[model samples]
Target chain A: MSSTTTTRPNGLALFILPSALMFALFFFLPIGLMALMSVLTGNPVVMPKVAFTTRHYARMVGDPYYLEVIWTTIRIGLVTTLVALAIGYPLAHWMARIKSRAGHALLLMAVLAPMLTGIVVRTFAWMTLLSDKGVVNQTLMSLGLISQPLKLMYTETGIVVGLVHIYVPFMVLTLTGVIGRIDERLEQAAENLGASPLRAFLEVTLPLSLPGILAGSLLVFALAISAYVTPILLGGFQIMTLPILIYQQISANFNVGFAAALGIVLLVISLMLVIAYNRALGLVSGQRELQ
Target chain B: MSASIEIAGVSKVYDGGVRAVDAVAMDIRQGEFFSLLGPSGCGKTTTLRMIAGFETPSSGAIRVDGADITHVPAHKRDMGMVFQNYALFPHRTVAENVAFGLRMRGLDKATITAKVKAALAMVELSGLEDRRPAQLSGGQQQRVALARAIVIAPRVLLCDEPLGALDKKLRQQMQFELKQLQKKLGLTLVFVTHDQEEALAMSDRIAVMNGGRVEQVGTPTEIYNQPTTRFVADFIGDTNIFRGERTTTSTVASALDVGKGLILALPPTEGQGTGVLSVALRPEKIRLITRTDAATAAGSSAHGIVENTNFLGGAVLYRVTLESAHRVLVQQPNAGTSRLFVPGDGVTLEWTPADLVVLKD
Candidate 1:
């Protein structure tokens, strides 16, 4: 080999260099810009010059509109997470327990079909089923359960319902991976120790799958808090969230700096919540043996 | 709790029309360390699972402690099990894993803690209470599995090749440990394994299974030395079998005519035809004799050439091929330093009729 060619980078560096450069450009640069903008808080009309200030952060803390939106986001995220878990745990258990290849294939199709379909298509399908003239309302009315068609769309209920539908597959797939790795013998061991079926589930299966639960909740909660499309389609005009407000600030008002500030605030808060969750759960924490 | 397992003509058929376990019937005594020994797909594991109440028998009934528990679910059977993979909950600490059964049974926190400590100490893992299963080595994990199973003080203990996953040395150690634990606790243990040495070492009584059926049930020595069938003789250990026909009292006459070439002589057995007998002789039971010794005719003998010689630590195995090209193996324990024979040497293999075991074809 030539001297120049022989002096080239090692194999690992050649592989890692390209992805590392791309990550720095697309990820760290935007994060840097957002961080700088969060500190810059001048109304462009009053001061055209780019100046740094903390007024936006102060306003974010003091204003009831921003506080209300944050609280609403948290509430929706928490409820959506809990509801997704309640439904996904059993479904995931059923999927993992199937012994036949065909049964497993059918289950995988059930979970993956909706996941692979377009998100807008799924939301639109739910829209037809949940509308005032939807099948659900018509069935209830014909069954004499209601005098009139109940308004099932354009409310917090609709938002949560849509979010849960969109997020439950995430929980189920995560749980399937975790539950499948668990040796079924532990559950059998529990059963043989005088635990009833329900007791074994509660004590063995549920607790053992907690890592999946934690991961799925973190993912759903993070996604729910920043959800823009579902709330816009289902929550109508009343439920204003941080993402919606940020979108309005940027697109309608053409306030790039303000939008960046809001984005930074949301990002910081979400990261803090993730860190707190990890700490409380006593995650790996550099403790390799515990893992 | 003391319990005896009586499987009355049990059979298990899967949905796809596969018979996993055929009609299997056996009685396991209370507090006995019984083994279901067989090759894979021979229904050993299925039988173990059926006795543990994990799998329901399709046709017959399973009575535990003389009570029919065939239809009862696994959890209500009140047995305890250790698996080959040592299924300790990875998320729980060792103490928590041991205390799981007590907590499920509604024991108080103090009692659970005390029992957990005792159980952990029993497996010699006293200080590993705070460690997760992933933190422990494979052997330690197996001990934790053992502690978890015993902490429940179960009615019966089921071990499905509990030592199969361990290394050879560790497996030997754990085998002794498990046997000692069984004796100390006086607990009924239903073990499953395909290792013959393991089965011979740890079992109080062994049920040799094949093709989803029990071939024989006996102690280790009986299974090895008194095999009733050809399959049993070949499976338990090495043996040299020859085809013969009983000619007189305690003598099996062979087709090979040496005027003195007798296949074997044994006690009379049950069979109708021309006394077609399958005679098995252990390798070490046959002796190598010199030409002068064979000429004297002091013992029943066969003439053959030493085809091969293997020096194994304190024993030597000589493969003797007769003029008929029939090979017989003779193993002799070496009390001195040198071997008595070499390859290509002519010798007479000698053994008395008493050493032969007559097997049904």
Candidate 2:
């Protein structure tokens, strides 16, 4: 405990100590080190002397290739978030309304089954289903819908599909918790007030679940942007997101400073998204209660 | 604009063969405030829900204004219901909640606004329009629920213990206000409550239910004084029940021999010499006097000692044990000047023979 623990009086500082320390070690310290590295003169290899420079940040700003990489990363993140939300929202509503405990548990288990597998394994599973000679192409060819297999791998679409498969369970779980917190009788009251079933759902349930949609979408977007393994394995050499570019700069080109610069850019993007999420959540929750 | 509802032989059988409402029937006249009163799991709520179209009866016909609505969906029934939790839309402001029913009916915006204004005024919730349900207190939320339901001018208003969440004082106040609103609107209201006192105080007529069956349905006075079933008598208030065979002590003295040495004289009322064995006697009807009169007082009386005393502020209830080991409950009003007895005091419990209600077995 520090001075803050005694000052808190309720011991909340002590209660949050573990998570704060974990965040520092896993996030804050690493980001701090990377920020220092981005300005240092030398690569990780042995150097004669160390000097401070802004070459990496300048290169990232002026280079067209780097800007394209940033845009591609944003596009993939947006598409993946949209797809996951489209598939997760209705699934969450249905699961939240399940009256029986066993049925709700079974459906939740089905949603979480993909998450139970490791990310690499889950990516490979999607690879098997999406490859040209795999089940998807084979079924489409046998059904005569196409003369040849579509290019499903080593592309941005494949990377998005893979990232969506990885993060949809997260989106659904967040949405389900929020939707479950909403009272079911609100919809009943709507129907009793003479709204039809669809109207009641649209007016009552949809608006109440807006907070969940916002949180889930932002979560998926953040996860999608930060994704490394899925994009590298699925997009391969055909795509260059910020993470893939950063990996190439660090490993193949031995540019540690440039890798740190890219890491900072990615961190900045995530921070902006988090700020937007908080503001939007505040607007919604503030409307629900008095100051 | 009220509609009379008739439910005939209605039953709701859930899965696993549990009968929540079995052969329940009621004929609710137009503009009447009828209440279905019972303990938990006694089918009062189930009966109310079936009439609201939230539940489809397993085998029955339900008619509103002589038109069968048994198979209709909940939204199409055109009845307003105030849930126990006062489930106002949390995202909507109070004004929006009140305007919902009017908008659903496709009323013009001007008419919707006026009716919403009037509805809020009726519930005394005007000018809290911009606040959401989360911002209001429990009683305020209840009023908003009532405003939301009644704004539609529904043919019937259904309330599922809407006042159950409020504190005791607030609940009583809402009870009076709700009854006033019902009378003013002439709503064919069907209210459900587990509290016997609340049901008795507010309802024009009440259906006393037990074990998924309506034991009796009548006005409050009739149900309290002349309970046809032993369950109704016991459930409505505190009373002592005697079960035995009916016997005559003389040509003019009819009595019920309730086993042991305790024989209770029966009043020669409407149901005399009709073999009605079991009887119910309310605690407050019996008089408690000192036993020092040397057994001079006659009438139907018993000698007993006070076993316990419960002080209810306005009344003192004494549990007296008779010589036959039969306990008799007697209640005396706490008039500050009256003689107060402790637990060890010897007393005589006396009542006229007519005070005993001959229950149907």
Candidate 3:
């Protein structure tokens, strides 16, 4: 309604203004404060920062227990990524090949329905499924496959299963977005060029879908590595990961500086893995020049 | 080796009870450059796909080289197809794309390399083997697709509007090259195209289709000049259709008494007297003469005035309003010796009975 406003050349900039402000306020501000807290002395959340110290970083490097926790955290992320990929690729490919729109929509709903539920509720559902007296062990026992009840809860396996249940939707969504866009004629062309159906998939569809795999795996890995609630509830003090250790420092010990330092370390590790994975994919994918 | 293909009454029906292809049969000889030409959704591409084993006929069969291949999977059928979009492997290098078929067959490394090199050379894309498909222009991508398909040396090659994406000049060039390649290899090539001119220019025989049915199958000359159906006549090129009831005019000649006081003389070869006769007259077949000289004309003649004149680079088309008020189109070559008639010039239209093709309407 103003003359100058109507005459402004960057009319499109108004659309991004709100999201840009929110991102700067909610994302960049928190990360900046966390980085600052990692360096400040004492409990910075409740009390004013008095002095700066490198003691938290020194303590983390000096402690072998912290390093092991980071390594285990990375291992869980890698395993979750691989498992999600294994499950998601087939589902994604099936969704891509489905001829009917209703079938595609139904399958998409089934894949994405779990993520619509709360993470805590999903973790609880997995707990009931994986408990020793749960339906899984009951069914296996009824089938006479296992004479003794397997210890399914409070272990790395239980934690991983819960993490995958919560994060696999992201993988499927990413993969489907990509694989669905690939031209079907390419595979038909491969088959036309004397490739069997399986050979056509391996030679044409697989390499073309590699970028999707990388993107989906990276998304799942980031979420899996940073996850705290599911690991805490499922692993039940038996499994040690960076998020669990950071939670304990903040909730039980009230060590804000140490908690912030651990959070920064975790963020750095995730960033490093993302960069390394991207580099590895660049070598395999002809320098990431996708159309 | 080239192979003959026999489509024995093949039909494809969809879930909605729509027949994409309806009982189409054709005997394609070995080493023939055959084309299925039609408008969109006329079953041309579907027929080609059925021959390539990409689609299954609902109630009929297809054979390749006298062996039934209707139930065979596409990979085992030994046919190479060039898709409209080129469909090159975006991730692979040009050389790798060309070598894919050879690798699938488990050929020796040296032989695959040699064949890939030869195929690239054939398409005039020898030096761009290391470049990815995204790095090349559309014409270059088309060449890559051609090289990839032909390097396999399959029994037959299928092209589904392959050059539809290219510009006009490039499409003509590729059309010439593809025809030459088909001849050089002596391979059976089934081409599907909606472009009638492209089909006429490249195909040894063209099967014109409309509404899920084949209207006619013949050489380019026959399809153009002697169209059997009204659809074929109208679809292939521009034509003036004259429809009227049969009447014997004074026992000397049988003439079709069209509306508006126009009578089209029937050829002597048309013996069967029909209830209603329909004929297609090409625009180029009619001659334009000044009304003062109209008395010297032969065959069916009419007096008209030029209503409009269209100047093409190599030809002139005149839309003449006849004495009966029926509009007739006449095209003449701009050979620079004959006077080009302008609009409002009085003219006489002349055409022999032989120029009128009786339509199976």
Candidate 4:
């Protein structure tokens, strides 16, 4: 009996031990070390001694530049989430209901083409399009809709557009997954129950697709809050966010202690937002079951 | 509370070169529980959808309450429909589901609540208004679907096999309940079902559809007792078919070409002797009697050897092989202590000529 029980746990260990080891090595250990470093105010290069101090956190809260960066990060996340949802819902609805296989394939290709392309390549393409002498400015100028080159590049508008382009696919994919699972007969039943098409959409389709909207919004918001590339390329030091600030503090200033404190603050806020979002949607229990 | 529906020359040719519903016309009178009964892939469902304005008829018109509603959208048609799977919105409470249509019509909050309560009560689900569809059992969800349809007081109600998902006993109960509700509400109902027994038991008039066309339309008794075509006779019930020639309007001399062959005298018919004719006798109509010879039995009697006997609790069913090698199904009620025939027992099958129905091939 002891031998059999030992073999059974060995079989269990074979399946679970790999992931447990990986989590400890790649996730929990690093997070623990990082959190420990957040409190130490000494040089990180050699035997950094632990010293309890909230000075870095206090400095972050008091500095106008850091506060502005935090506000800008949250604002960009909100704007990107809202824009992606607005475009994703209708596109996902169309994909879910169109009966023709060929049409569905075409729509799928359209969504996948941009997503499958590397993020850097897509961002480069957007940069060109938003450039002063690029297609957008030239077209607008030829159409008499704008004066020469209108200074559209390296602005918050450019950053938001690029962010929306990158995150729209995520929102679309999530919404499509949810909307596809909805039984279409409910919409037909709503119509037969004397609801107009618009009313039926509002009362039935919209409410049923809420889970998709919430999930997509959370995903896009998280990605947008942590974004580094698009904002750096487009904001051009004008729109400073926490990631850029953290990178400068660590790499340029070599202020690892201050950077670690800022990193801990950002990580805590992101984790809290994720937890609150899941709780509000009642999706935490569902996600746990899936895990 | 009820409205008549008229479908004229309705047809649906799908994009895949299939005529889902051929040109068909039907009129459902107010307060009538009409059923479209057919096998799968038949046009019954398509016809029902056309009436509900879900599918636009390819070449014809649909009118509800004397208005041409062929061009109107489904929601504007003022009709109610129940799906086979009971398409209740899973995200909403029962009251919210029932009140959706009322809210769409811009009804006030008080009126909506009162009507929602009344509709829930109608389906015997008054206390379940706070429950979501997923929380209810299959039967309760179907009732909620029914209430959601009727809450708006639509002129017509269309049901596409609403009880198709339930077990046999539950289906039977729902059949009775739905029929009772239809009668009680005086609502014109166009129900679609493939189960012949369900059509027979509930419909005021049954339209038996086949391959995108209506084959026959009649009361249950007429459809059972006097099916005009071979398809109708074969589809409705079990019967013994004997091929024959019509000697007259009511008499058919057997085509078996034997001197002592079967002959049937059927009820009167206006049209006769136009084609190959056959007599269909119900299994229960044939009686088994023991006699010294087949000639001693009353009415038309045939001699045969019992091939198999099945005791079905209430009745004894026997498969009898005639001398011509044609097997006839005969059923006899089991009453009192009696001699039950074994497989090899010689028997005489007797039935009155009036029990037979002559069908045109």
Per-prediction TM-score: 0.89, 0.94, 0.94, 0.90
Poorest stretch of ten by lDDT in candidate 1 chain B? B250-259
Of the pair 1 and 2, which is ahead by TM-score?
2
Query: Global lDDT for candidate 4?
Result: 0.83
* Every candidate's chain B TM-score: 0.91, 0.96, 0.97, 0.91
lDDT of each: 0.82, 0.88, 0.89, 0.83
All candidates: DockQ: 0.47, 0.60, 0.64, 0.46
Point out where model 4 deviates above 4 Å. A1-13, A43-52, A283-291, B242-279, B290-292, B295-301
Q: After superposition, how far is residue B129 of candidate 1 from its true place, in Å?
A: 4.5
**lDDT score for residue A219 of model 4:** 91
Query: For every candidate structure, what is the RMSD over all alpha carbons to the true structure, in angstroms?
Result: 4.6, 2.8, 3.5, 4.2
lDDT of 3 by residue, B107-146 (tens): 9999999999999999999899899898999999999998
In order, the interface RMSDs are 2.8, 1.9, 1.7, 4.6
Q: Taking the true A–B contacts (Cα pairs closer than 8 Å), what share appears in each candidate?
A: 0.75, 0.84, 0.81, 0.77
Write one digit per residue (lDDT tens) for candidate 1, span A1-291.
586577666787888888999999999998997777777765445767868887777887889888898788788888999999998989999898889889989988888888787777877877888889888898999999998888888878888999998898888898889889777887887787778878877777887776678888888889888888888888776788789888998889876676787898789778987897787556632333355
Q: Of the pair 2 and 4, which is ahead by lDDT?
A: 2
On DockQ, the leading prediction is: 3
The sequence of per-residue lDDT tens digits that candidate 2 reaches over residues A1-291 is 587566545666588989999999998898898999899988545887878999999999899999999999999999999999999988998899888888899999999887778999988887898888978988999999998998998888999999988898889999999899888888888888888889998998888888899989988998898899999888876898998888888989988999999999998998898899889888877776452
